[model samples]
Target: MHKLGYFYLPSGKQIALEISESTNKYRYSTNKDKVKFPNIESIIKLFDQTPPFDNSRNLSHFEQIREFTIAKGGRKGFTVYIYECEFNKMKEIKGSPFSKYGDGHESLGLKRGSRVIGRYIDTGKKYKDKYVFSSISLINDN
Candidate 1:
């Protein structure tokens, strides 16, 4: 089992998202507007190739979330955000890519979080404990 990514909401809820390989153009621009969250593929790769969490089981959900976000212009307009998960904070033994993303020393940020919602089951593993957060919609509540 692999642990790719995870999420925690502001309500103190924790979940482990899934990750999967996608073969589609992430970002796209039409004659009308440019997709806000472009390069979703890159983002997935970023999430996948990042580190410690790479082998985690959260990759599938993470990749799915990324796809949904990109399709709906993530972080743009109004988004129906669900649970929020903090990866870097839930550290175990070895260092993880997510933990290093926002260590207050990297260019990412001091704190990194993602919004999602789904059924999560606890695995009780040292670091394999998993959660499932899944849901997709437009940013404008459409």
Candidate 2:
């Protein structure tokens, strides 16, 4: 299983966190699997370098995030998963305007446990709508 970690945010604030590894190690079950999945040590280092919004302690092992949820401004009636970027480099790749509108890697939404280096925003208008990590970015601690 591939190790992935996530910190939950409500109203742009960190509440709780969870760390887990995938049961299927051969490949990601979803299209958004390209995002890097970090192991235990990498997770800790990332947290230490970035620090948590809540200043709460870090998870000791991999598991599920049970204490965090979507904030009010978030998509009002949908479920969202938050994760940390296991890898540091995420560059934008242009694709068809119809990208993510068909099937397979082209259409599948972000995996429930997938990690992205960007922040999330909800306009309270849709369930499958949110922003992606941008090419013009911030937070470089490598």
Candidate 3:
């Protein structure tokens, strides 16, 4: 379990960010397994950088974020995993359209915990129905 950091929501609940690393280190392949997972020191530097997407509610992580400019400290190969009790028992669903983080990532309909709601992100534009992250500052200093 490559747990990196946790975030405290406005409601007091917590969200955690972890890296999905290849368990079989010996089997590691540069082509198949190569990720730049964020770290504490690097995370702190990103505090000033503009977010991948200012409006996270309308976009999924894959959609809202594309790339992060890191100064140092990151896993060579890993996956970013955001975990939370709120996501417990949560059913997997489809994410938003292509934008930044790209497709393949799942999006869920959530009504619990502290949330930032957004409207339809498509060209048609609909009413509020999406949930998004409030910030990218997931570093748990304490």
Of the two candidates 2 and 3, the one with more favorable TM-score, higher being better, is: 2
TM-score of 2: 0.20
For every candidate in turn, the CA RMSD to the true structure comes to 19.0, 13.7, 18.4
Give the alpha carbon lDDT tens digit for every residue of 1-142 in model 1: 1232323321112112222211123233433543233245644544454332333444576675565445645544221212223463332212221222123112222233321111222222221232222232212423
Task: Return the candidate ranking by TM-score, descending.
Answer: 2, 3, 1
Name the lDDT of candidate 1.
0.30
Give the best candidate by lDDT.
2
How accurate locally, in lDDT, is each candidate? 0.30, 0.31, 0.28
Candidate 2 CA-lDDT value: 0.31
Q: In model 3, how large is the Cα lDDT of residue 126?
A: 17
| Candidate 3 C-alpha lDDT tens digits along 26-124 | 245665655545466644554444433445355444433232223111123212222222332222223322122212123344342222221211112
Off by over 4 Å in 2: 1-21, 25-37, 55-142
Given candidate 3, what's the lDDT at residue 12? Answer: 12
